[model samples]
Target: MQFTQIEYFLMVARLEHMSKAALELEISQSSLSKTIARLEDDIGVPLFDRKGKSIHLNEYGRIFYKKAKKALDDLQEAKTEIQELANIQEDSIAINVMNSKLLPKLFFDFYKKRPNVKIRQYVLPDKLAQQKLIFGDIDLMIVINPIVDQRIEWVPLFTEEIFLVVPKNHPLATKESVSLIEAKDEMFIVSETGQNFRATENHLFEKAGFTPKIAFEGEDLSIILQLVNEGKGISFIFQHSFLDTYLDNVKILKISNPVCFQTVGIAWNKNRKSSFVVNSFRDFAISFLKDSANKDFSN
Candidate 1:
């Protein structure tokens, strides 16, 4: 079957309506129908069930659709890789990251050093970023709690302490540090479920033998901090120099008992071949982080 036929099949499989798929594909309904029929004939099995002018994938169709979609995706990825290879001198580096706040400085520093290198950065949740790295959709990832996978390698960057944050006027705000169990009854603001920070917070609470009463859950770190500033609830945050800007009405309390923290790292898939620009960027990032770490210690 033609590659276009596979493309049409996937489109029809997704929409499950011949007329709708035809409209979206900008092809005549009859032509789309013929392509689907020809595809089924070539495979020697009826892929879809037709009833009352609507068509839906049957078991055979569902199985074929999954494999066909993956095949097309692989082809597209190959084409992209080929194009990147052909234009290696004007390379673009794609990175998936957890923290976007650090990217502006990091990207600008890299750009200043290598003016021709293009950087594409994405700030995604922990699990989604890991998925992108594993799928070779991105060249690298900056993340916390790097998942242990044989296909992926992690380079340790640094570790930051996780602190319990509270509104300045809260009862526990005056203390230098507090235990998770001490605040067990207090309402907590936390990141959404799949994030690394949220998971770390949950683990700390669980270790303290209690689950926090979540008052609010958000995807944005700034929003979580805002909720704390509003005295909605207390939450956990990584200790960072930049956090001072957001802490005018909030207090960062140390976690004395569990001493919760997360290790940040750069992760990349070992199976994927690195282009010259990708390698150079990776080396530059490692050197930059090392220098920054040394400066932090010297200060």
Candidate 2:
């Protein structure tokens, strides 16, 4: 069937009223009704059940609706990709990133490579990022600690060790590193339940047979850092998430001997078809990281 037919079907199915759907589509009510009838005839199934002015999509229609939405999205993505290939213009990339210092380095590098394409970045917590990726709200994600899901394909970018953020004046700040047992009683400023970081923190505490006195719970890294700076509580975060430049009051200390580490990665829906541009970006990211890692190793 034609795209217009599918559009009309979706609108009518959503509105459930011929007049309302027609008004929304800027078409005559009779024309809308006729088009629906024609579509049903063409498809050889009754798509909607009429109960006076109200209507509901039949089982076949409900199934068709799901497929139709995916088809529409694919068509739109294809059109965008085609236009982008024509002149490398008018394309946008959406990425959900777990807020971290390395994010800017990655984003700026990608932007330098593709100045024409608009990059939409969403700072999502790990759990929400995973959820969004699965639901197709985001094209891909750069998560701090990768979460496994059947719907996503994850590629490892790197691994980073977790560090404790303590105020410089705090007693633990003088030490080069601290163990879980040493910091067991310290009040913690932790990420909320959904994030993998929070999960790790909780796991460590559970392993050590202690529950930290969590003073603040949030998803924002900056906020978590700020709380630690204020001496409200100490926080555990990935080293990459903390910039080395300097914080006014907080000191980032490594945790040992069982170093807490998390793998940072990019995740995208497995079922979604990859465009050449997306593939290029992914390839570039992989190659760039490999080269960078090799350079570091050689040095």
Candidate 3:
């Protein structure tokens, strides 16, 4: 019925023993028992199954516990939002980059607007970025496949196709588009296994129904492009990555069977109190990426 009652109920639900829950809650066993009894009376349901020294939540109690936890979460989120709105601080923003291809220009554009603000950026693997976000070590994450977490909020910026790249002289290069099955046996030059782009392309492999035969693993995009150019092996990359660059003997082709694409997004830890600079950058990134996607689509 009340916040304290709900909180006590949740604690008891977690611990499943009244005396243990009371000890942990720093309340007397008698008081805790009376409060829980009052709560059950108000709710008009027997919430717990008791056997002298042992206690466990019944079906009604289980349902109530879930709803109570969610209600508390909503209230906490509202409180955090209000506090952030009331205090607009201009702190340095820390960002992590998992999808690195598009972030340079986006960060540069933001830097131009807020000339006095400092924007710290780091390129990290998937797991480390998530740990940093959870611990409040980072403010924003630019990623293709955003981390899925209840406390993390993500906003989509743009989507781009992942193109198959091969040496221009390769047989498949002559074809406009071919299914990944067409080159199932070809050795693949790829980024290291755990990188974000590699992870996205890994899904394409799953959809295409085969694992790639790896010829080499390149640490950077240019290395992959170079290896592909030499006819060493074929690779996959984003369409927008090499749009302005000249590909001497490399061809960016399309896979028709299972279309490979990734949606890039900006993610932040909603639990952290973001500064005005970080929020403004987030707003600016949404618009800038929308415009970029439109312009690229038109071209």
Candidate 4:
């Protein structure tokens, strides 16, 4: 019935775990459980079917969730509008990106133009980014892989071709570009299996008709680059890597033959009216990269 309760309900429903939701919301688990139980009792129906260590929403829960979501969204919109009418700048936008390094540059250039807006940036893996987008948790996402959703609108930001990175003294490091087949026999230092870039590596190997001899595995880009620089193995990176790092011993080469490229873009909910902050940030991000074409990025 209360706004606070509605917010708690949405969080609980989204997570479907009492302890997890409670930890996230900074409330006691028992308090959260009691609150949900009371809400369900008041409605004379069970919202969630509780099994050991799991919770699934029932039919009534689904119906209530749909209505509750709309009500909360409408309330937020009303508040935003009212704040605007009073000449107050009060709005927050959440951005989910795989690369954490891109956020500061993305926001610094954007937020300078709109100083009053609040920005929340999250560094997440590709699958989680798409999941959060579909769940309406994040307002916008900058994803490398294309997320085709009817309710989502995609705007092209930049196109980056994957580069083969090696130690400066390596023979292949002198080449401007190397074909996938040429590097087929080389060792790879790649991300984990479920990661987007790892999948891209798999596809590259599949196209070359040979499995790469992977020498090392890492999640962080710096560590991966360090591994490569130490002559552990070669790795793939966006062309931006050349400009972003000061590692003197690393060399970058474009991948040719297949000419593979990842399409980076801005994605937002099509059904929702985007705020000025979101749109402005979007415009700034696209223009910043375009203006600095062939320039280096730090990460």
Q: What is the C-alpha lDDT of each candidate?
A: 0.83, 0.77, 0.81, 0.76
The runs of at least 3 residues in candidate 2 whose Cα sits more than 4 Å from the true structure, single-residue gaps closed, are: 1-87, 207-209, 242-246, 290-299
**Model 1, range 15-71, lDDT digits (tens) per residue?**
999999999999999999999999999999999999999899999999999999999
Which window of ten consecutive residues has the lowest lDDT sum in model 4? 290-299
lDDT of 4 by residue, 1-299 (tens): 56777788889999998899999999999999888888888788999989998987899999999999999999988987766544377667888865534456757866566667788888677667767777778888876665677888777766767778888888898888888788777788998776667777788778767888888776566778778878888887775443336567877887777777676777888777777667666777777755453354323
Query: What's the C-alpha lDDT at position 103 in model 3?
Result: 63
Which order, best to worst by TM-score? 2, 1, 3, 4
Model 3: CA > 4 A from native? 1-91, 98-104, 242-247
Best candidate (score: TM-score) = 2
Better of 1 and 3 by TM-score: 1
TM-score of every prediction relative to native = 0.65, 0.67, 0.63, 0.62
Could you report the Cα RMSD, in angstroms, for every candidate shown?
Answer: 12.0, 8.6, 11.5, 12.7
- Candidate 3 lDDT, 164-256, residue by residue in tens: 888888989898899999889999988777777788777888999998899998556677777788889998878667431756887778888
Q: Candidate 1 overall Cα lDDT vs. reference?
A: 0.83
lDDT of 1 at 89: 48
Q: Which pairs clash in the backbone of model 2?
A: none
Candidates 1 and 2, the one with greater TM-score: 2
